[model samples]
Target: MKKVLFATTALIATAGMAAAEVKISGYGRFGLDWNEANDVAGALDNTDATNITSRFRLTFDVSTETDGGVTVGGRIRAQAENRDGAQGRATFSSPQFHVAYGGLRVNVGNIWGAIDSAPGLYLNTTSVGTGIDGMGFNSLAIKGAGFDTFTSAGVGRGGIEAIYSAGGFTGHVSYSKQNGTAGTSTDANGVERTALMLNYSFGDYFVTGAYQSADNGRTITKGGVAVEADDDVIFLAGGADFGQFGATLQLAQTEEADSVTLAGEAEVGAASTVIAWVNSTDIDTGVTAGQTVTDGTAFGINYEYDLGGGVTFVAGYVNTAADDNDNSVQAGLHFSF
Candidate 1:
C-alpha cells in the first residue's frame, strides 16, 4: 500500500498525467543455523551448532513518469538480519535513484556494484545465504587478471551506473570512487571500482559475462605500494530453462585462483554447489601459499511449498570448508507481503 505524501502529488498526477506511485515489499525468514566460521586458521576449530539466523527486509519503490514519457524512480531498503544469535538492529541502505528513457537507464547513489548486480554472473540458491559460503568463494573472486576484491566494499559516497537493454541483449557499466579523507588524496587508503557486464538471452537459453577491476592499491610516502592489477576478477554464467526445470553454471577466475558454481531448480525445490581452489598458490588469495589448496566444496539445497497468501515453507543448507568443514541447515516459514 502507498500513501500520497502531499496534495500536490495527487494534483500533479491528475493535471500532468504523471505516475507517482510508491510500493512496499519484502520478505522474512527465520530458522536454525550451525555456523563454525572464523577468521584465522579455524578449520580444525569446533564451535557450537544449534544457532539462530533470520532476515527481514523491506523495500520502498517510489516512481513517477512525466507526461513527456521520462520515468524517474528510486528505492529505499530497510533490513534486519541475524547470524548465530547476534540479532542487530534494523538498518537502512542509502537510497538509489534511476532515470530511464526507453531501454537505457542511469542510476545514482547507492547503486549495487556491477559484479554484484550483473545478471547471469552468479547462480541462484533457494535458501537464504550470506555471500560468504562453503566453497570459500563468492562472486567477487573473479577479478580477471587482478588479485584483490572490492565488489563488496563498503558503501562509499555513492556511485554512478548505467544499464541498457535491447532485444535479447543487456549491458551494464558502473564506477565507484571512495577517495579517502577530506581533500584529493588518491594515494590514501581508498577504493576505485569499475565493472562492465553483458548478458544475452536466446529462447530458453542465456549467457552472461563480466570484467571487473578495482584499485585498492594504497601507497605510502616512505614505505611502498601494493601491486596494481592484483585484484582483477572475471565471471561467466550460462543456463537453460526447460519449463519445469532450470539449470545454470557459473565460473569465476582471478589471477591467483578460480571457482565454479552450479545451480538447478524445479517448481518446488532447488540445489546449488560451489567448488573453489588454488593451483600453485603464487599469490595470497585464500589458501596456503605454495601449497596445493582445495579451499572447500560447498553445497546448498532447499525445498519450498507455497501456502498461499504470499507465504511458504522453506528448508535448506549451506556448507563450506577451510581448515575444517562446517555447514548450516535451516527450516522456516518465509513470507512476502
Candidate 2:
C-alpha cells in the first residue's frame, strides 16, 4: 500500500480543516484455468478446455479526521479482468462514503449489505474461495438468494448501512431500493430489501446470525406461470480456531432452498496453507409438476504458498453440484500492494 498526505491549508483555510490522506492499494492475479464443462462437444462448445485468466484492481481510499475525532472517508476502485477468451475494459466503480465515531459507523452509496458482511459467511482463503475467481463461489452456504456486496465496477447496489461494534459484539443493518414502479400489487416492478446481522466473538470462537426480507421481488414459476412474491432469508454460522487449524459451519434457509456448508483451514508449514469446504443444498424448483425438488453436493480444495513480499502461488480444484457433475482446476500467482 502507498499513502499520500495533502495539506489542504490553501483550500480549507477558512473552514479550519485538517490534512487529508489518500491510500492506494490493490492486487493482480493471473493463472491457467481448466474446466470440464467447457470441453464438451457439439453446439455448446465455445470455450477451450484450458484458458488464461487474469485480473487487475486498483483501489483509492481517502480519509480525514475532524477536530472532534470523527473520521470521514470514501473508497473507489478501478478494475479489469479477462476470462476464457473475453477481456473486459478497465472500469471505475461507484464510490462508497462513510462517517465513523468510535465504534459506530454509517455508510451511504455502494453500501455493503448486512448479510454479505456477516462473519463466517465466506471461507478463510486469500481469494475468499477456491481458484483465482472463486470458481463461481459454489462453496458458499447461501444459494439462490440475492445479496449486496462490494462492487468493483459499475453503479453497484445503491444502499445505506450502519455498523456498530463494541466489546465482542457487532451489529449491521442495511436497506436498498431499486429504481422501478413500486407497489404491493403482484405487478410491481421495483424491489426493496432490508437486512440485519449480528455477531459475537469470544476468545477463538464466534457466532453469527443474519436475516433479510425482500418486498414483492422474488420470482417463482407455478404451472408455467411466472409470479412475483416476497422472499425472506435466514443465515446462521459459527466458527472456532485452534492454533494453526480452524473450522466454520454455516446454515442458510430461504423460501426456495436450504443449504449447509462446512469449511476448514490449516497451516501446513511456515509458508504454506490449505483450505477446503463442502456444501449441500436442497432446492425447490417452484414448479408444481416435474422436478419439484432437487438436492446436490459440491466441494473444493485450495492451496497457497507464500513467496514473501505480497506474492503467493495458488492452486485449487472444485467439483460442482450440477447434474453433469462438472469440475475445474486452476493454478496461478497472486500479488498485492
Worst 10 residues of 2 by lDDT: 1-10
Task: Kindly report which residue stretches of model 1 are placed more than 4 angstroms away from their true locations once superposed.
Answer: 1-19, 36-47, 125-157, 181-189, 217-225, 228-230, 268-294
Cα lDDT tens digits, model 1, 57-118, are 78778778888888999877887877655545677777788999999999888776667665
Query: Against the hidden true structure, what lDDT does model 2 obtain?
Result: 0.83
Error of 1 at 19 (Å): 5.1
Residues 122-164, model 2: lDDT tens digits? 8777678798878888888887668878798788778899999
Q: Report lDDT (Cα) of residue 187, candidate 2.
A: 53
In model 2, what lDDT does residue 130 have?
A: 90
What's the C-alpha lDDT at position 11 in model 2? 34
